[model samples]
Target: MQFEPGDRRRVLPRHLRPAPAPEVFAYAIRPARPADLPHVREIYNHFVSNSAVTLDERRSTIPSWREKYALLDRLGLPFLVAVSPSGAVLGYAVAQPWAGKNAYRYTVEDSIYLGPGAGGKGLGSALLQALIEACEQRGIREMVAVISDRGAEASIRLHEKLGFVEAGRMGRVGHKFGRDLGTVYLRRALRPSRPRRGALFGRSR
Candidate 1:
């Protein structure tokens, strides 16, 4: 999909065309790379610093982002990003284990964030749909989204539009910015890949 810059909190880099003509640009969604972590952190820290959309109160560091990237790589989970034609990281979507216990292996939690100028253009939905499909391909049975109830109505609606149903809500579970905050949980079941022939049987061939 194509987008024109609007309401950007920052100016576009010199590589991008100026705003008088409203430069039309496109972005590609693909697996994230190690170098993309910095951009990812920048985007995530924006929410952490400015809004109640996320429960986190501290800015994330590059080392932490690298650790997360490495852990997801080792676990065979999906970490995807959207990059503009000029190679700037526009946004990212990732999945992590829903719980540390063995029984929750088939379930994962989704996280998605877009850059300052990269929202409201179907980008979040695109990234989330891609994440869901990636999890399905990995034999995951369920995906969950835990969103803040403070100022995240857009996020809830986005998840709902992509078939996620409200699983439950937990009130006063988190405190950030000197206010009690809650979480709204949404879940979606995926079509996991079928097992290969004789995979469930004892080895007797």
Candidate 2:
């Protein structure tokens, strides 16, 4: 059987880690609507045009990206955009179900894309934090990040600071831009679904 674009072939993993306070973002977090696809497209295309954040070297079109958003949204996953108060989309982030297997429902892999200006600021963290919260609300157990090993120091560091730990690294699993590349997997567990007392939610029930 052939899997669809967002379909996975394995089961989700179990994650049982503590939850933290509301993540601080220099920008605001909001769900990505269909209208936001253009901004999302631009942000992602920048990475494809200039970075190794994704193995997909080809520039993605708005329709293709919208399809991804629709799939994840249908799965109850969060596809968010971090925008400036003036409404400029700085970055985007979301998690996709890890595997198609029933047991893998709780395990999801994460992805993030940001414009050049969005880096060095708190945009990525803000987006990640929101995604984490969204996952926890849906009873998601584990979130994984598969990052390319080339020039990804900031991404690796951000995940580390966000409570994810290095799980595994596969060497030379990808070849992009005419060079062999490695990728690393990082994971964080979100348990109990509820935020702590006096936390961002203000006295968790």
Candidate 3:
């Protein structure tokens, strides 16, 4: 008797089972909420304590993250996260004022980090792109990313792929893990999400 298409007993051989499709990585990108701070801190502090990707030697705490969350909200800057279906924060990216001065109001610096096993799965790119779009919508002009020179080549390439241009580099700016580390600065000019309704210096005729 021919096996019916719905037959479950006919276990296909390992090679013959119409090769099971690759499992898809699933996550959603969205603005970070206050509750996500703990997870965000965990992701960043991992790099801080175990790697040279971040220059900070101090581990990030939930309190500090809360303060940051509040500051970003007050400034209307974007702090985004990628969360798994179960609501776990998988990664995060945030933009802060490039400098405290009023002259720097239109520019911002970005920080991004992924939780363990979250990299190489397109999460970094997705988070960065979403952050860029959010900034553009808020009328921000420029974005800067200062990435570590050690063990961060992937981050640099990801930024470049998203239209960031190398602005500059500084060698030996930081010493961590018994070695001097440097940073590569990349900059991207952001366009408004939508054009102004009127022509420059004049209204449409």
Among these predictions, the greatest lDDT belongs to 1
Candidate 2 overall Cα lDDT vs. reference? 0.80
- If both were scored by TM-score, which would come out higher, candidate 1 or candidate 3? 3
**lDDT (Cα, 0-100) at 182 in candidate 3:** 92
Tell me the whole-model lDDT of each prediction, alpha carbons only. Answer: 0.87, 0.80, 0.85
TM-score of 2: 0.80
* Best model per TM-score: 3
* Tens digit of per-residue lDDT, candidate 1, span 46-135: 999999989989899999999999999899888999888788899899999998998999999999998988887878888898888888
RMSD of 1: 12.4
Cα lDDT tens digits, model 3, 1-205, are: 5878888676667887676687667888777888888888888888989988899999978888899999998998888888887788888889999978999999999999999988887788888888888888889999999989999999899999999999999999999999999999999999967523211110111
lDDT of 2 by residue, 58-115 (tens): 8899889879988997887778777766677777888898978978988999898887
Poorest stretch of ten by lDDT in candidate 2 = 196-205
Instruction: Name the weakest run of 10 consecutive residues (lDDT summed) in model 1.
Output: 196-205
Task: Please say which candidate is ahead in lDDT: 2 or 3.
Answer: 3
* Candidate 1 Cα outliers beyond 4 Å, as residue runs: 1-22, 194-205
* Candidate 1 lDDT score relative to the true structure: 0.87
Question: lDDT rank, highest first?
Answer: 1, 3, 2
